[model samples]
Target chain A: MKIAVLGSGNGGCAVAADFALKGHDVYLFDFEEFNENINAIMKNGGIFVDGDFVGFAEIKYAGHDIEKVITGADLIMVVRPAFGTKLFAEAAKGYIQKGQKIVICPGSCGGSLIFKKGLGLELEDESIIVSETSTLPYACRVIAAGKVHIYIKLLGGIYLAAIPSRLTENVLIDLKEVYPGIVPAKNVLQTTLQNGNPVIHPAVTLLNAALVEREKGDFYFYEEGVTPSVGRLMEAVDKERIEIGKKLEIEIIPNPVLGLIQGYMQESNYDTGYSKGRGFKGIKAQSKLDNRYMNEDVGYGLVFMSELGKQIEVETPIMDSIINIASVIMGKEYREMKSRTPETLGLSSYTVDELINVL
Target chain B: MKIAVLGSGNGGCAVAADFALKGHDVYLFDFEEFNENINAIMKNGGIFVDGDFVGFAEIKYAGHDIEKVITGADLIMVVRPAFGTKLFAEAAKGYIQKGQKIVICPGSCGGSLIFKKGLGLELEDESIIVSETSTLPYACRVIAAGKVHIYIKLLGGIYLAAIPSRLTENVLIDLKEVYPGIVPAKNVLQTTLQNGNPVIHPAVTLLNAALVEREKGDFYFYEEGVTPSVGRLMEAVDKERIEIGKKLEIEIIPNPVLGLIQGYMQESNYDTGYSKGRGFKGIKAQSKLDNRYMNEDVGYGLVFMSELGKQIEVETPIMDSIINIASVIMGKEYREMKSRTPETLGLSSYTVDELINVL
Candidate 1:
């Protein structure tokens, strides 16, 4: 399989290395501003993976040229945060090949929609298969310049769905070879709603905003930051997400159960699961509240969900609240800025059934 | 002057004692559930004032009888939080005399409106004068039963406004004798808009939520919790508040300036002022995120401002965000459960000018 991974952040590096080690021709590309990781990998001639997936993977191509990375690529993974979604899509506009599969790893709320819009492609365009996963498959981080630490390779329950609702199966069939845990979701709506990033990250990060700013990532975020009361807030937000799913007639996994499946928790309850769970044992809080945990999850993910809730007539007070708090903390208007919604996806005029059919 | 002080919380105790020492016939009342302070005062036959105001102040009356407190009282002050605005109004309804002046010290965002609704009185009702102050004058706390440690008495900049635009002068004249810092505002809109509590408390408390929950109020709130980034958020919310005031043609002192006026902060900028302010020194953060900072301030204060902004077609994104975040953390629909707005105040149908007139 020929794969092009966009962005060389922690997730991007992990994906590129894992694929390259599996003997797939992997091309990793990042913008000039984000070329540090890829430049390090290029200099090192390979990426060293530790923890669950331990190996050195030699990437076939590593550069800033979007055309060089996308040309003739069988699968293109948009692995950047929501902040970079549009930029990557814009870069991939003229270069995206026909019949190529595009996957937004950990879509970070409406990634597919944002990408589709950015690509200037119609929502119903079927020339290229576009899919998004609920979250990234590997709970990994960059330990060094060129070395990535793969914490937990999710054994099961990584959800994948395609825009226009038809291309999910084919995309899943190919990607499942690398991520056996990946499963086909009903639609992009399912994949979007199933995203627990917006549910957990922003709330947890904002709840511990001052501490994160104070400690500079000194403590385990999940273990120390998420107390009983904070746990209750996470549950309330999770309930709102589930309620939105019910309204949309989409089957979504609850947060705790999903956390267990995603290898983020041992318990199927918020407090015990997040605080004591081995899956999140070594995960440190973001050094600042302005990181992707907020910018991506709250700014894009929660904003998208809130917009979706407005479209579906389901009140997402908790999601709105998180987006609101994140926007203030980040000094940006998230809802007014980039957000994935029915309107943005060109499904604003569609009824719930019609919208479901289209997605 | 015969004054009846309602609610036995920190502010209420301070008000009761201050007025009593100033030779006013002060009647302090609390519900049975909150009668502990008054009971202690009754037992002590006075309130022990320590800090800025130092001495024992004899109370003419101290009990749970609302009638005993309201009867023959020239002035009635509701110093409870916004949470008790309605209950206090209900308690003071029939007992309130025709010529008596009622003041909600530090109205906590639309307290005058909420009080009017609870009292079932028209905004135009001039037989009795109703007024609200931008904030409580003294930043004090009760060290023990019937004992309060006064921090700083505000020298100036406590805004006072009446329900109708007409009654502000008389209310200000009387309140000035007790709270010399009290100055006449344009209307209740000025008083409500001038409130910096909703701006500072909810953001700071929510930002430092996990730390507060974990440490149980061990650290000084402003000095430790209001980091540079968190201070930026406070400034952003303050901007939205200032915008609301502009839209309504009401003059609002910026949060930092208001803080200086209310004696909570000395510096004019958020970071330098809050982190280093003598007024905010030694103030402890709430032990939990569910306290009045989130509950009263975000739930009522921000909600009211957002609603007003919506009515006037002014955007209050930051205020809306704070309210939303606070609501989720507190596990309640603050906008629905408790909020002071045009509709809640029965002024929903009024135009901007009419609303201004009524307020």
Candidate 2:
């Protein structure tokens, strides 16, 4: 399969490397400034995949030229966070070949909707098929200029939904070739609500605002920072998220259960049949300040969850509190700074049924 | 008027010294450890008042004897914070005579309710009248031992409402004779909601959590801490407060108007008002590790407000957020540590009408 990987961040580098190692023709395209990174990749001549991208022999290409990357590509994966998803998607719309499937690994909840809205693309824009998974497949980061170090390969069947439902099957086929573990969610809303970042990250981060800001970010955020009380708050927020999901009829695996799948929760804590680690075999974690977890997850993902609650007549005090607190931390109101809200997403006045229909 | 000012903390010393100057037989009582503070009375034998307690005299009656202070007292003003209001009320209950009145200076929205419950008394505990004002009249604290410095005296009618309707007139007469400024609120609920501490303190403290924790007992609390965003949260909380009051058919004052009364907002920038030292008159800044703003106001006050919102079905996201944030900072689950939640206060499952009846 011919694949074009967009964005040269952690997710992009990791995804491009993985696909290339899997004997797929992978052309990873980013900007000129990242040419140092791309040139290093070319010098290395192949990706070093510790888990998913283990073998370096089976490879294709890496570059700053989108024209070369997207030309006759069978699939295009938008691996950037929610902030850059729409821009890359619209850019792809201008250049990509007709019938190229666009897969967003770790769609961060609202990416699919973003593409459809940002580009003014119709649901029946048959040439482009947009699908999203709940999260990227690995707890990985770039080890050096060109080398991506894959850490925990996350597990769990990712949610896959295509625009207009008509092209879903084709997109699913393309993603299945890459990720055989892909689990099909009913629709994009299910995929969006399945987001763990908004439900957990912002609640903990905003609540622990003082701790983080006190000594200038020296804490092991998850291992130590996510204490019992913080976990309870996450549960409170998770309650709201699950409630909204239930209201929308989105099947929500419990947090601990999902965590077991995502490798955050210890499955040994419970007798559930779920395994210990979420095998994120294909992606990396972006540890930058402007990273998705803090910015997009808090801003976009939380906005969607909170707004969905508003639409469904569910009171998400925990979610709203976290959103507001995050906004204050970021020095912007979630309603205004958040790229997607019920208001920004044109769903502020939407009824539950209307929201479901629109999504 | 013979006045027994309970609790020889800042308020206690100030009240004792102020009443003594007014020629009332004022007896100040506290634990024996506060004898060091008696030096303020020893140095000058009374408070050196600049504004309200202007004239200093050595009329010495400050002691740790509760029984001696209560002897022959006409009015015993219970000036303790809400957390200890119950214990003080119960303690005062055993010491009072038939015609004596127990006035909780800022009935703090529901002080009478709490007082009546704590003493195992009924709504018609007519013998001992319990009334409250919106707040303490003086913006004064015992900065040094026994030295109760006065700031701006709040220029509003202090609210008052007796527990039993029968004792309302008698209580008013007693309180007015001493205070000469008691504006009778409609009920205990009215007086309780009149509390501006919950509306102001927690919002500022929690929003400034990062700064407070980072600065670590070095920053100006009320005078320099309340930012515009903090003020917005205050307004949001106040809106919920007013909504709760409306649902319960009680009048709660607006926050901005209250701020205007506090002399913080007078069409001036924060830096200007704060730098020029014109913000928050009567309210001295807290530079202690333990802030009453975070501990009492956020813990006791916001939990009370949150509980009230639950009773009235009004959503107070900001209030709950600040409370939870404060709890995180203090390492306590505020909702649990809070003795004033709707559930704890016996209003947990009350209907609107039922809550109204209780109020």
Candidate 3:
């Protein structure tokens, strides 16, 4: 399989490295950050796969120069955060070759939908299999400029059903060799609702702000910070998310449990378990620096969730409160911004069928 | 003449000393935390007073106990930050002699009402004349345990208004001898509406929390922190206050103009002319350990003002927004607290005629 990765950050580089190591032609396409990593790889021509180590193997191409690297690629994975995703999608729109797969590594539930919308590509626009993973593999980072460190790439979570579902088999066939862990869910609605960031990040961050601001030592995010008071707030937000998920019948997991399933804890519920902050089990979490969680997750993830909750007649006081608080804390007025709402995400008034078709 | 000072803090101690210095019979009551100062004052005789260099003379009477303090006093001023006034008022209820004057030194806008209501006294409770001043007499603090350090005795911006206008002249005769600066207003409405704390505190604190948290080093409370954004928030609050004042037919001066009238500056409005950062000359800037504007002003004063605005059908979105925002920042659900709303203050259900009669 010939593959290329967009974004050289934790998620992007890991995808590129993993595929290249698998004896497949893999290319990493980022803006310019992949250069030193590419340079180091050019010398050794192999990525360091440590955790569950496979072996060092050669990747053919890794560079910021997207066009030259993306040429003749079977699959192109864009791993940028939500903020840069739109811009990267626009660039890819012009470069996409027919039959190529542009899988948004964990389209983060809504990334595929967001890209599709941003490209002005409607539900009918069909040329490529634009897919998403539930989460990226490799809770990983670059140990040095050229080195890739792997931390047990998330083994299983819900990815997306191809927009038409007719293309699901094709998407799975192309990426399964690279990520055997990918599991297909119904649509973007299922994918997005499964977004754990909105459910986790804002709840953890808002509850632990004082601790983060004061001592700022690593906090057991679920155990120490999510007190009963904070838990009630989370439950309120979760109720809204769960209500939306049930309406869509996506089987969304509660946040702390999701962390457990993701191999972060020994237990799955807030009452008993501990989340050792964002670094999943201190195993080098694969999440981006300031990407999907704040933007797509909370931005698209929570926003759409809240909007849908409102549509389905669910009260989301805690969710709205947290979103508004984050907005102010971030020095932005999110209430007036459309980017975080269902209306903006093309889900506000859509019938589920319309949404599924659109996604 | 006999006078009892209910609270032995800066305002209370200063009031006790000022009257005792004039050779009037005076007594001061406070908690035993002031054991050292009280013993010293008992030995040294009374509070130290000064004019222009003919200064620091101990006057008379260190009546540390309540029974000893209230004995034979013609007038007793309940001087405390709205917190202790209720307890002190209830304590005084048992000891207050018939027809004695109880003047609330700087009665917070609703203090007289709270006091009267606490005693189960009727609106026409005229035996004890309740009055309030716009502010305390001296720019002071109790530096030591019992002794107050007076910086400047403000002889201006003081308004005294009795509960029943009938008792106005009777209260003034004694007040004149003690204050020599009391400018009588029509009633408690004028005095209460003249509060400057609510107008200044919320705007400064809410907008400057980051600065306050970042640099506790030499930050001016007034001049530096009250920026344009603070001014806008304050102006909104001030307009609400003035609208309430207008509805009640009292001209409560806005903050900037009040500063000018108090001889601080010649600024007319809060928008531009009044510069913050440098602070009022000779008056110690209110840079307390924590910016207490949230608790002291917003919680106490703005709650009063916001409620009053509600009674008058005045729109106070900005004021409401600040109060709500500050309450969240403080981690309290203050918005739903009725004591925060005008209805709890008896103004919500009051007819225009009833308010006039109560005042």
Per-candidate TM-scores read: 0.84, 0.67, 0.69
- State residue B260's C-alpha deviation in candidate 2, in Å: 10
Ranking by DockQ: 1, 2, 3
Error of 2 at A359 (Å): 9.2
Q: Is the docking of candidate 3 incorrect, acceptable, medium or high quality?
A: incorrect
TM-score, candidate 1, is 0.84
lDDT of 2 by residue, B110-192 (tens): 66678767767776566666666667876676667656677655555567777754456677776554466557666666777
The candidate that wins on lDDT is 1
**What does the lDDT read for residue A126 in candidate 1?**
91
The sequence of per-residue lDDT tens digits that candidate 1 reaches over residues B1-359 is 98899988999989999888889999999989987788899999889999877999999888999999999888889998887988999988889879888899888877887887688888778888888998898888998998998887777888888878678887778777778777889888888889888888877887888888888988889888988768888888888888888877887789888777667676788887998887777888886666888877877788888888888888987777676666666768888874677677676787887766656
| Per-residue lDDT over A88-195 for candidate 3, one digit per residue giving the tens place of the 0 to 100 score | 787676677777877776666467766777666775567867776666655676778666676566655636566655676778887777667667777767766776
Best by DockQ: 1
Selected candidate, larger DockQ, 1 vs 2: 1
Residue pairs in steric clash, candidate 1? none
Q: Residue A217: error of model 3 in Å?
A: 14
Error of 2 at B294 (Å): 7.3
Model 1, residue A80: displacement in angstroms?
3.2
Worst 10 residues of 2 chain A by lDDT: A268-277
